[model samples]
Target: MATLFLGLNANAARMDMVDVSNNNGYMSAAEYVSMRNEFGVKAVTVKISEGGTYKDPYAASNIANVQAAGLYVNGYHFARYATKAQAIAEADFAGQTAKAAGLPVGAVLATDVESQEANNQSKATNDRNNAAFMKEIQKFGYRADVYTSGSWANNKMTIKGKTGWIAAYPYVVSGKNWYSSNHAWQWSSTAKFRISYGGFDVSQLNSDYYTAGQKSKVKPTNKAAVKANNQKANKNTSKLVASAKWVKETKTYTLKTAVKLHTGASTSSSVITTLPAGTTVKTDQVIIQGGYRWARQPRFNGYGYLATGPASNTLEYVKSGATHTYYTVKYGDSWWTIAQRNGLSMTTLASQNGKSIYTTIYPGQRLVVR
Candidate 1:
């Protein structure tokens, strides 16, 4: 499930914004509110810096206004020089701001690691410094999350036990998927908005706000617990066997050779394997090794090995009569697709079919096309 997340950088008063010469640099209270309402944004993250010349003049009031409008609020800090002392100061500033604004629901502190100063620390050093800062902030009774680009988070930083606010715009990278134990994802640097500010246009900032939901749905704190539970649940299960015999549904499957294996039962597990189709296996043996469950061999010969190539077949003309219509199941389709195809909402479809969207549907399931 994808949850909408909205991020507002209250550090428009910062020098970087001023230097960008964009109208989004400085915004007024009214403009901010209008933008939030227009975007249906649920959260706003204000920026606090340690020693930056630019400061948010209305940080407190901005946060209050956002919360008053019923949006969740959080605070961030630009780690100038990326030192333990600097991080501590930045964390202190963030804590003070959060306390002043009464933001209690969302994450409290974020380390903005980007800097132009010569004193800016290396990735590892900055990561450690930010971690130190977060540790101190945690002492002040607030949860801290790290804000960095996808590359930095995956390749450079190494701060454990902290949630991540990944910045991966345009097309979200594999590393940007927050489902891998991070808390939130920043999908875009430009998002659409309706607001104007002090000689600055809040609308200009809209371009940087496109992002996708996390791929992995597990929360950071509970990941370990969930993994442990899952491991325990599958402890006795050992190798997954075929629930039913399935033949090659695609041309990629070969005969007799040992193909790649998957551990999980779903398509997500399929991604981690190098398995080919059509390989003959034992009736109750696991065929693939993937994340969650193993692929069980299909029950019958033709049903299991029927090769369906990856090519998409476009059935342009369906029977005009209400009796024999055709529908296509897409990559992201579930019961949701069937409902949408019939011009019905999820609730209506659920009530009519007596089934939830979570109910599994297989390919070629005869659904109402009319």
Candidate 2:
């Protein structure tokens, strides 16, 4: 097992931990060793469950690997409940899944409540639901925390004295006093690391955040690792960029249903505002992320992404003009050929109507072309 050592620069805040989910895929013990030795990571939290039914497939391996690499291992659940009953059920699922995934007793188990439905609820309701969840998860002998954005941590729900894990990504991450109210702050989702596709979600934890036993087992750090860690934490190498695919053509679209506009393409991105149904706007690009098709609409200072519809289909939420044009499938027609003939990319053509390049289109079947 890996052990965390004291930092060389005592004044600089430590980027204490990194959290992972199925989105990050599988990581080996060797990979975690790199995270510890190279990046000075002290702990890891694996996503264990979501809602009441879904369990993250990667949780078990991740938990075992983190322990094998000698890093403190904990678990978190993606919450989807709005009512007390649902919260209890979800909490039970999270606890069971965490135990099954090898998370030891007395480790922290967190509830990640960032869904649009949960965020839209009244504060009283959210407070009640969060309380119910935290209370229920403690039955399994794990400490609990509510994981949310810094804004939600401050404004939306009460933590009931349990230390909260708050996330707020600013363009630049520096200083010792960022997000001082919470026990832990997830400062960067795009933190530079050798693991994963894009970047790791790096967090700074209070010195006492981990259990006493976990902290007691710490090993001493060498000079090189401590120096590298401080430099990276104070000034990360990567800059935040909008994750969207721009297109050459700009088109007008009318919203078929009300949808939230996000600062970025993913649903997990911060919500800017909600646009009502029948809203019309010109979009310069389309981003297919998190199973959704987000249209880049003009905003005051920059652009916001409106989730027009599922990546499989956008016609349900938006149309190009007063009405949409469709084409009937005929003999020998293919998605690529049809898209080429209509001057559209096969990806856009298929995604516009909730179909894929592999979707079977028989003669007389209709497809949205415009």
Candidate 3:
């Protein structure tokens, strides 16, 4: 029994929380780090196990990888119990697995109890087992909850005390549309979008539910660990400031003609990226390559080799009226790559920033992406 969901997302804090299972395909930490930004998620849920001992092999990796990415993490255990004792045992397994897998500071453990096998039992039996699962998981010192279809919750499954993570596809409205109080509504079964390979089930925790879930997760007890997390946040803030400074101290320029930004200092090397005529160029330093002067930077990732002076591209510094501008360079970004990402032509990008595509752009160099 599933209820339809519809309504403007008027309630719930509405933070992006996506759930993934083995069906979503394998994703590594590197992939999660690089692609997680594309989805703008606040939290991620990974399937941990089913029944009493059946574990999802990739659950450990997915949970650990996402937690490492500094996102709020949650784990859900699929239920397949016909009795309270079995439900309790499975609940314990889910809780222990989450702890063993390093499921971040404020992670929730959810009981996914929507299997037809479980539902085949009388509604009375389903209600007892589902409640038992939630209760047992909560006993393990976790912020435990339940996830099910709206119809199941209404007529079949019964979980009254704790929060209910409802999945109501088709009607697919918002958290507020559901009559269930303080519920973390999952409005769809068909994932709305994709991050890497397959789609993911999306849900939102109303502000109250979201905040409560976050607050319940235990904090890192080690002083050093707390300091490390703080340092990561502080480093990002400092990097942002440095990028703003670079924009202030630097003058913007555009390429006057087309030029090849190569992988090495010499033109014989493969082309790293191309700069069409009129591409904005920015560079911190200039180097001589093949008896011709070229703009070079330490952070350009082996790209942006253009002969200096008025011949290949004119070097002119311009100014902007904006309050601030900055773009943090990623691990494998060239000036051309950065320009392409921002939808600007190579010439416009290089010229506006006055940087050569060959500038060695480090992983953290602040460039003006805008």
Candidate 4:
């Protein structure tokens, strides 16, 4: 079938496209759902591994949520291995996972490859590997497509007969463009739309442009199935929370206390409660406040008491001798200034301090003034 170019303006149709690669930081299942609902994402592409090695966490839940939303869903795998056997194995893994999850009809299986130096024999080998992978997926009775950059398609990969999902962001290349002959063209990287879950800015691409025969086969029964699917999905989501890593360590305190307290400006003023010595708070919950923003705590619920007037900026101090009188440097503390005030020399002071003449000292840094 000939390739189709779904123009950028056509994105008003409310299609949400999600890139589920491992590179895009970790997102919890709840976060994924929130993002989907917030951004109105209509489709999610779960990224499986290249060599059929690893699957992401909450994969089942993510798929379930997408299915419940009555949106199109698909899978893509990074093609790290350029050999036919490796590609086939990766395809097998994707096919099994997709079939198991009962992905909706008209969904696609995609291969994502980019410009990278690899042990693959040649560009032809990469092409052969992708073709082999697609063939494996076809064995399981599903359609497969290739996703590649425009430059890569023109310079490296060749797609003559196979359906290609071209990534030609920024602008639609000319009709004779490398990716123009693709089954679907990713025209814009920033396409805005709304979904039932929420609204989001998605990329402009022909997500799944079905041929006449394929389009006819898929009946629009998704709307009717949404409510029932969502009920089951909510149950699955609850199960996901149980498996989630939500220890107290993850809770963060924005404000010191739920209510703000006033502090009197005096040395004996008990403005803030000191944490017990050796009391260890979770790394995730405790955030170090500094600078101008330190005056107020973060705005959140259930935080403890507020801290007043920069509680001992330094956390630890080394006790030296009977007393440790740390002195701050005054203005005009040059070699001449030191000699006139403390009777020290330019060379002697520089050598004793292990500093050059050009060293720029700060206001509060302690030095051996005596």
* RMSD in Å for all candidates: 20.6, 11.4, 22.8, 27.0
Instruction: Give the per-residue lDDT digits (tens) of candidate 2, residues 1-370.
Output: 0112226655444557889887565677887887777666788988999888999988999999998988988889989898999999999999998988889998889888866557568889998999899999999999888887655665677653337887765444433556665678776665555433335677877645654345633433445755664565545424433344555537788876577888987767898888888888788887555545568888779988876654322243677775578999999999978977876656567877887778887889998886
Candidate 1 worst ten-residue window by lDDT:
11-20
Candidate 2 minimal-lDDT segment of 10 residues:
1-10
How well does each candidate superpose onto the true structure, as a TM-score?
Answer: 0.41, 0.63, 0.50, 0.44
**lDDT values for all models:** 0.41, 0.72, 0.57, 0.45
- Candidate 1 local lDDT, 1-370, one digit each (tens): 0111222222111101110011123234454455444433434566544343435555666566555644445666655645677667767776775576564643456665533221224666766777787887887677676765554564456634335655433221121223235545454333333333222111111211111121212112323433343333333323333233323321122332223343334432342344343443332332221111122444443212111111011011111112335565555677756765665545445544456666676775554443
Per-residue lDDT of 144 in model 4: 77
The alpha-carbon lDDT assigned to residue 132 of candidate 2 equals 92
- Residues 1-370 of candidate 4: C-alpha lDDT, one tens digit per residue: 1111222222222223555543332334554454345443445666654546666543555566555654456766666556788788888887776666554445677777652322224778887888898888877666677876654564456766446765543222222233434555444333322111212223333324423132312222333233332232233222111111212223222222222221322222353544442332222222212210012222244233222212111111111123323346666555546533544334334544667556776655555533
Q: Roughly what TM-score does model 2 have, to 2 decimal places?
A: 0.63
Top lDDT prediction, candidate number: 2
Deviating ranges (above 4 Å) for candidate 4 = 1-16, 21-42, 100-106, 115-121, 171-180, 187-202, 207-370
Q: Which of 2 and 3 is the better model by TM-score?
A: 2
lDDT accuracy of residue 219 in candidate 1: 19
lDDT for residue 176 in candidate 4, whole number 0-100: 29
Ranking by TM-score: 2, 3, 4, 1
Q: Can you give the lDDT of residue 36 in candidate 2?
A: 78
Better of 3 and 4 by lDDT: 3
Candidate 3, overall lDDT?
0.57
